[model samples]
Target: MDTGVEGRKASRVGVRVSAVSKTIKGNRVLDGVSASFPLARVSGIRGHNGSGKTMLLRAIAGLISIDEGSIEVFGEKLDARGDFPVGIGFMVEPLELWDEFTGLEMLTLLSSLRGRPRENHLRSALTRMGLDPDDLRRIKSFSLGMKQRLNLAQGLMDAPRLLLLDEPTNALDEDGQEAIRQVLIEERDRGTTIIVVSHDREELDRIADVQFIMGDGRIREV
Candidate 1:
């Protein structure tokens, strides 16, 4: 597999939010946030509910309109800047997939949109995530943890250089959470930058290369 030339100036995009602030109606969500999520490191976003954790992730993902600020990904500036979804993957608001499809099926279908995916990639994702391949049962039949693993599998099928996950431990047991954490650490080790929004301070301590604690829609260095 061609890993591409390292350090080559190929329009590489890194997540950069500078002095970003967002307000909805009359409530402020993100207040003049400025941060840089570099390439190939895991950063944790922790905050109270409605503190703008998810909103911040969404803004970075280009899912919402930014009121004010600059968001750059893969090195491309976003918000009237240009396209920056080159190598970004995210899972939030529940892994949306065909509940009728198998885990592998979901991975292939979702990844194929990005490009060709290898059989080993999908299979390896399943194996590494501790999901039994034989559990080819419909996604609707899988438990929350199983579904979450499937979500991770699909997101990783693209081999994204930058991936963002929100509240990743939402529906997993201790073992399942550990497995997800292991995969995240491995991703970081393999030069994949990751940004995860989690409330589990301990979990963040385990995988985060840095931490940002959100308060009143603003991140305070902790």
Candidate 2:
């Protein structure tokens, strides 16, 4: 990974949550789960199946309809309607993508959705992720690894402040996984707050500054 980017801050920021909780179908999925993320550091959410790791991240990203408690990014509380998930970026478990759209087309549409994502930045980000522009021409027809690469490119397009990734290493080869690690490190260095839910302990150990273990919807620091 290249930690060679200039014009970046040396110190990382902080993310805090207060009295946070979430439930579904009368079942409390996340129980009073609250934690903080330090700036320019990688945090890991590790847990077994159905442990609410994804749910917690979803709530933080405003993808899930949060009903209880609150989330804060950079000391600001997020209301459902406004300033929520401040400077956040995320990719969930199910891997949402427009199958019929070419990789370039998909990214272009995403750029349009967020006002405007520099055309040059999009190509550069994809290159940094080890993807060729040619890959976009047939991305939907590519394998899972290709799709994952596209996803990574998409999430990093806007260079969001807080990034949430669920099982990002899955469907990737060793080289691809290493590439992602490098990118994550570089992004953290660029002051992007990151939270990843992964099953690989060794891999998480390499990236996480803070780690959490989840159980029965409750989370505790490891």
Candidate 3:
């Protein structure tokens, strides 16, 4: 794959975690984590299970509050007591979907909650992910790969300025994985700030302009 943008760098920080820490059930899930995810680039995070990768993403997405330190998105400090970062599209792991709803129906419902994106836009998102928007099958009948693609389509449909994905290629085959890589590259080129969490080191290396390793609640660049 073409190495992201020709001259991309962390010159402008999109998401900044400043000495952030989080504790849960007497376990430190985040330990003074500080990192900068640059704008218009793909930032990758990889770690073993329970290594705080997801928790960090949660903090960035404002889904969870940090016990210590702070987080800023696009130069605005995030307030846990306030609203989430605007213009962000996040798809976390353990994909959740309305089993009884068809792909189109689900997208329509979600879009309604988010200002009702046009019907064509929703259909286009599904088609881009290789799903038939007119298909009548319910999500419960979809294969794991299909579900993963739907999850990605949900996050990408609106073309948000910031994209946060967790294990985006989970359950996808080789061809599906390649499609995801290309989509990420395209998003980066469009100046969308992306932070993706994956367990596959090789896959991250292929798409990420910068990569970080999370272990025992701490992170270091690699």
Candidate 4:
């Protein structure tokens, strides 16, 4: 299958947020947060609750508009209305899955929407996430770990160029967490840029090429 588009000329092929800030309901969330998540490496963001970590991820994912500063994915500048930066995938706090669709069916549908070739790519992603591609159970029937794996499979199946995962190991045991870590490392080796947000400092330290700590809406390299 053809991998998506390639060769976007930029100083880096990943996410760049500059002096970005946001406010929600008159409350400041991101206070001049600036960071560069480089291509082909895993960059981790560690922060406590309400520290603007998830908000930063949302801004980068084009899920919300920033009240100040700019965000660029690859080499392209982003605005409120533009299509989500191409070749990007994200798994955030609450996933909205079609409870009626079987795991493979969901993958097939998403691939169709994304214009990605199905077959090998979708199955490979499921396998990588330790999910059985042939599992015919509907998403509502899946256990917590199974649901998490399915969420991951959806994000990774198309081989996105920039992957943003928020608390990727939220519902998994040790083995499941290790599987995700390995997959992330593999993705990095294959030139897929990654930005992960987790409270697990040790996990970030173990896998991240660079690490940042977010606090009270501020971000700094650690």
Candidate 5:
């Protein structure tokens, strides 16, 4: 995608949040946060623990309902009735996987739940994530980094228009982290709108087209 000033000016907004707020169990997690993410760009969010970065992503993904305000994805307003945005791929923190399934088997099962993706496509996704698609080891035997890769592969295999990732580099080594960075950049260049949350400021600076910092349930562009 174009990074020039005119190109940026011509870009359309992919996700828009209007005065959104959410309180969970009497604790305010998001305090009237509002932001716009441009299509075909990588937007990065950074904040300390409990600063509501993850919660904000969750709200955008429609995994949690905002107590007030509105969120729109590709011009469609998100409903409070747990309706997820169409054409979205998200991998939030606290990864969950089927412990009894192998990497390929798990992804195959997940893809089956949505639509019938080719078996070869599933294998290619695993290979791109540096996983051995033919490995028969169960997920329970995989290490933390391997599990993280599997989680990302599942989210990205479908090639959605919008991608939301929270701490995508967690548990990854230097090479693995670099691989993810390249993948994010490649996706952005392919006109995919990406919103990523990371604690590494330097990494965000390198990959993010725009950056936001969250504190005390509030957000400010940085």
Candidate 6:
């Protein structure tokens, strides 16, 4: 809900995927895909199940190795063997969180890992996602929607330069989904390069500066 951050342009450095290919269990997931995502804008990808959308995101996050080709973020190559790419925040398909930890605590842990302060940004991110920052309930007690919100909170807490979210609006009511859209719009305006995968075409049309349609292990702009 803060529109003040709007209009800040990204520093013109973004991501490039060149001839990326991946295979799992003898099935081709990404077949020589290549694309460039501009900074400070949102790129939306829409696809059916098993269309390799999530796989592509994981590869960009360096969570999985590509069978061939390369991914570059801000002009730097992403290596799975190296530390997580700096200024990158991602929420792929399988989000792992500590069940016993409170929402705030979970974000605190991530902030610690990134060597950043937690108190302010943690609360801000939670509230922006329509969750109560003061709630002390364990993450295990959260509903599906709340858990999804928490997943988003953690990704946004670090103020990442490059954000990758898959099915970001899953398990949420319209209000909650709208809140996320607004947050993403603000982030995009402030020069945070973002890539989102969603089944909702309306959401994609509203937010994505460029759109990609994925099918049969290949991605193409529409």
lDDT of each: 0.78, 0.77, 0.88, 0.86, 0.88, 0.85
TM-scores of all predicted structures: 0.86, 0.89, 0.94, 0.91, 0.94, 0.90
- Model 3 misses residue 86 by how many Å? 1.3
Model 2 lDDT-worst window of ten: 1-10
Model 3, span 11-107: residue lDDT tens: 5888988999999999999999999888778899999999999999988888888889989899899986535777888898775799999999998
Two-way TM-score contest, 2 vs 3, winner: 3
On residues 92-145, what C-alpha lDDT tens digit does candidate 5 reach at each position? 978679999999999988888777676887887788889999999999999999
lDDT of candidate 3 vs native? 0.88
User: Residue pairs in steric clash, candidate 1?
Assistant: 12-74, 13-74, 13-75, 14-74, 14-75
Clashing pairs in 6: none
Candidate 5, RMSD to the unseen true structure: 1.8
Mind sharing the TM-score for model 1? 0.86
Candidate 6 residue-wise lDDT, 61-139, digit = tens = 8788888888999999988443478788888866888999989999998889889966998999999998888898999
Clashes of each: 5, 2, 0, 0, 0, 0
Residue 37, candidate 1: how far off, in angstroms?
A: 1.9
| C-alpha RMSD between model 2 and the true structure | 3.8
Candidate 2 residue-wise lDDT, 1-222, digit = tens: 122444233434466766677778998888888787667678898998889888888887777766677787777777744343546767886766888887777788887877766877778768877877656465558789888888888888777888889888889999999899989988887878788998778878877777888888888888
Clashing pairs in 4: none
lDDT winner? 3
What are the runs in model 3 whose C-alpha is more than 4 Å off?
Answer: 1-5, 8-10
Name the runs in model 4 displaced over 4 angstroms: 1-13
lDDT of 4 at 165: 96
The model with the greatest TM-score is: 3
* Model 1 residue 217 CA deviation in Å: 1.3
Looking at model 1, residue 114 earns an lDDT score of 66
